[model samples]
Target: MVVPAQGLPASVRIHEVGARDGLQNEKAVVPTEIKAEFIHRLAEAGLTTIEATSFVHPKWVPQLADAERLFPLLDDIEGVALPVLVPNERGLDRALALGADRIAVFASATESFAKANLNRTVDESLGMFAPVVARAKEQRVHVRGYLSMCFGDPWEGAVPVHQVVRVAKSLMDLGCDELSLGDTIGVATPAHVRSLLAALNEEGVPTSAIGVHFHDTYGQALANTLAALQHGVTTVDASAGGLGGCPYAKSATGNLATEDLVWMLQGLGIDTGVDLGRLTATSVWLAERLGRPSPSRTVRALSPDSHKE
Candidate 1:
């Protein structure tokens, strides 16, 4: 590991979304047993917060249609958080039926993205989530709110900082434990990230209550994560093996890979509680299942016989 960097959090809590967000956009429907094993491997690799699946309509996301079947198999796994996405009251109800303790609600910072993704306007979407968040909190289930397109949107060019702050605050006010600001299109630079964090702070949203989910379309994920860390944001979201892209965002690409994030955190001596070798091996294994190589550069570099020491 490299020496620790200054002005950074001593440790970061990586919310791994590979199983959910990563596989959601894949064209092939991964087998339910494979999904179960993937989640198991992730936990074995020290990923405590693994997003298992989304409880959306089968017509909307056919890949995760087995949420009901997949969730039950995770019951034997101990000491790990498997959060599933709940889009509405029904989704929440389904998750609760399966004894889900951690849930995530997703919304967009841009009106176009909201309408296209959720078929509702910004305010309407939040209104829809109000009761869902309330009921989840009522059930004592942990809720994470996702604010997509926080930096830029495909339909709307550059998103204003206030827009993101407004949506984020609304989610927080609705009882979300943490708001994950997503650069859904991967257009955010480090400066943009800093400005957004500064603006959110000015709006009285604590850095502690924020996490960042960046896409690597422009290869700025790590740089932007460093910016977020410097601004005192301790939670960061990453997908294992760079496995995800926003299905709703046409210009978007894969998410920041867990292996890449782990490499950087390990090099900086920042604790993420992930085992890099096992993570790399897992990603390689997953890539084989997906019938392609992982998009993560770190995984490629660290794979056996891929490079010289």
Candidate 2:
């Protein structure tokens, strides 16, 4: 069996989408400046990729309703890529006007989710985004596509593999720098992950073009990530403090915790380029500000090995 290879990465690129993906579903409205500070701390911790906020209307997602104001505060950082979620032309316009260096467009794998989330068919959603991707390309802004419900869906049971490939191909064909495959309901298993990656590989999809985003709803997030790593997938999306959920999928939980993913990767001798200890501290700080215990099991574990204390 293959492994993630020993030692540290020259530098692993982890795009912390927690502020956007992780916090979007939250009930509380985090202050705009506070969100800026949260992202600042993430960068200070060496996370080069951070998804700051979505350019969607506040009525749709009140948590990230501050995408416009939040954009400028996070832009001056030199090394980090502050990609905002552009829901359509209007959203894309806002991002471009703000000089966003990178942007993310989203589409779902199933029909029900398409209507519920995007109010359009899958094909329609892709068609709508073609121009957006072109515009981003024209302006030299990096584009990333998010394919939601690549695994099981809350409304549609047992997602077919073909559906995932179709959307992936559409996104990549449209010039997206990368495509993030999301297990929206956290219903994926390692077996499912391996099969999907294999299919994508056989279809000539570069692993470099792929990124995995999982939720630990059933506690299998790390196991699924291990499968992705074994397949030579380099990029992974994680959330600090594991803050996030599917806005439409009510049962969904937080993302695969960044602290948890880092803890496991470091333990396996893989090169993630992250300081797990500092990540733990950051998680603690975020949880305090959010007034909740962190969902990261690894963060909790390091909290005074009562035996050691």
* Candidates' C-alpha lDDT: 0.94, 0.85
Clashes of 1: 0
Please name the candidate that would achieve the greatest lDDT relative to the true structure: 1
Q: Give me candidate 1's TM-score against the actual structure.
A: 0.98
lDDT of 2 by residue, 178-243 (tens): 989999989999989989998887887888888999999999898998888877777889999788
For candidate 2, what is the lDDT?
Answer: 0.85
In angstroms, give how far residue 152 of model 1 lies from its true place.
0.5
TM-scores of the models, in the given order?
A: 0.98, 0.94
Query: What local lDDT score does residue 37 receive in model 1, on the 0 to 100 scale?
Result: 94
Lowest-lDDT window of 10 residues in candidate 1?
A: 300-309
* Candidate 1, 59-170: lDDT as tens digits: 9999999999999999999999999999999999999999999999999999999999999999999999999999999999999999999999998899999989999989
Error of 2 at 180 (Å): 0.8
